[model samples]
Target: AISRWPNRVDQRELRQSEIYKQGMQTRRRVLGDTHVNAAEVQKSSFDAPFQELITEAAWGHVWSRHNWTLRERSIVTIALLAALGHLDEVAMHVRAARNTGATREDISEALLHTAIYAGVPAANSAIKVVKNVFAQLDASGE
Candidate 1:
């Protein structure tokens, strides 16, 4: 499995290379160019390398995997992040859900499922956040 892409990833290859470029194209398409651009822009003199490393390792590496559907990954992410009370991360993933083919209903269920392991309070908060996002997306016809 690891042999698929090779040991090191070259972000530049995301432009010219087919497989690497395909993965990055998926990332940008799902996450939105603005969010991706903003993240890249924030990479300062010190944080630049670290930012590339994580994006390459996490977004480019793990998320780039073809084994799981983005929908499956998004649902799990929302639930786990909600349970941990990481609302910020939850919102980010919520935004990501659009790309994963995961609907609001899926997100709602994921948060509801979290109620079992996490407390009701966390689930409730996640619901509110998801609701707000739903409204926003609805307004934009997204």
Candidate 2:
């Protein structure tokens, strides 16, 4: 259970919110249960609030929008993360891209576009990370 309104609603009621339910479903769909479980497992008291915030805000309010397909959102996120040198998130998103129906070629194209605006060096690093993620995925037969 989680509480978006920790001060107002109890944890059970918070989890019952349409926003929270939709967010958890979307998060599990886009990110996968394994990754979500890992994060939930590792959550500490200090970071639990932050985790809930992202799950509700980022996944619920923003990601749940019907304006764009999940594939489109994943592509945009990959480009932004690569451009910003958020290599860790880049890797995570790259791995999750498949769940969103993003092919490796799509990710490559996104990174290539990022190079034009985000710089060749950033794209270069992201390319390396992408290759590694693909290799891991391939090995896992995912």
Candidate 3:
């Protein structure tokens, strides 16, 4: 694979490091293995850097930090992404939310709060994504 070593890993020693393995496991746990797999699947000749940047900043740098619990980060993430219409990032955070103990109700309330401050259309679109995620998670029996 052309894209494996995450941020903060020595490019040469990542294969033998416990920290690298733990970081990837953390990424998989919070963002879902399937999502990570799909990203790997789509790594192209030119777009690999984009995915790597996410692993570095989002997963390695941000998620690896202890500033907040994953649940709180998820709440802040979903609301901010919803407000800014970062639809591309919504699913990852939603899955992270589920991993970190955010419920469907919690997501709904965050969206509601987002609506008042971020505009109804943004919240509306985000809520739709939320419903679809819950439905998919339920369908998978998880």
lDDT top scorer: 2
Candidate 3 C-alpha lDDT tens digits along 33-76 = 89789878988968865766666666777777788987877888
In angstroms, the error of model 3 at 130 is 1.1
Candidate 2 error regions (>4 Å): 1-16
By the TM-score metric, which is better: model 2 or model 3? Answer: 2
lDDT of 1 by residue, 2-118 (tens): 577677786545543444455566668668888878887786878866765655666676777889988887898899888888988888889888878998889888887898788
lDDT of 2 by residue, 78-122 (tens): 999999999999999998888999889999999999999999999
Please give the ranking of all candidate structures by lDDT, highest first, separated by commas. 2, 3, 1
- TM-score (C-alpha) between model 3 and the true structure: 0.77
| Local lDDT at 77 for model 1 | 82
Give the lowest summed-lDDT range of ten residues in model 2: 9-18
Error of 3 at 85 (Å): 1.3
Q: Give TM-scores for every candidate, taking all chains together and pairing residue i with residue i.
A: 0.76, 0.88, 0.77
The local distance difference test score of each candidate is 0.79, 0.91, 0.79
| Candidate 2, position 21, lDDT | 73
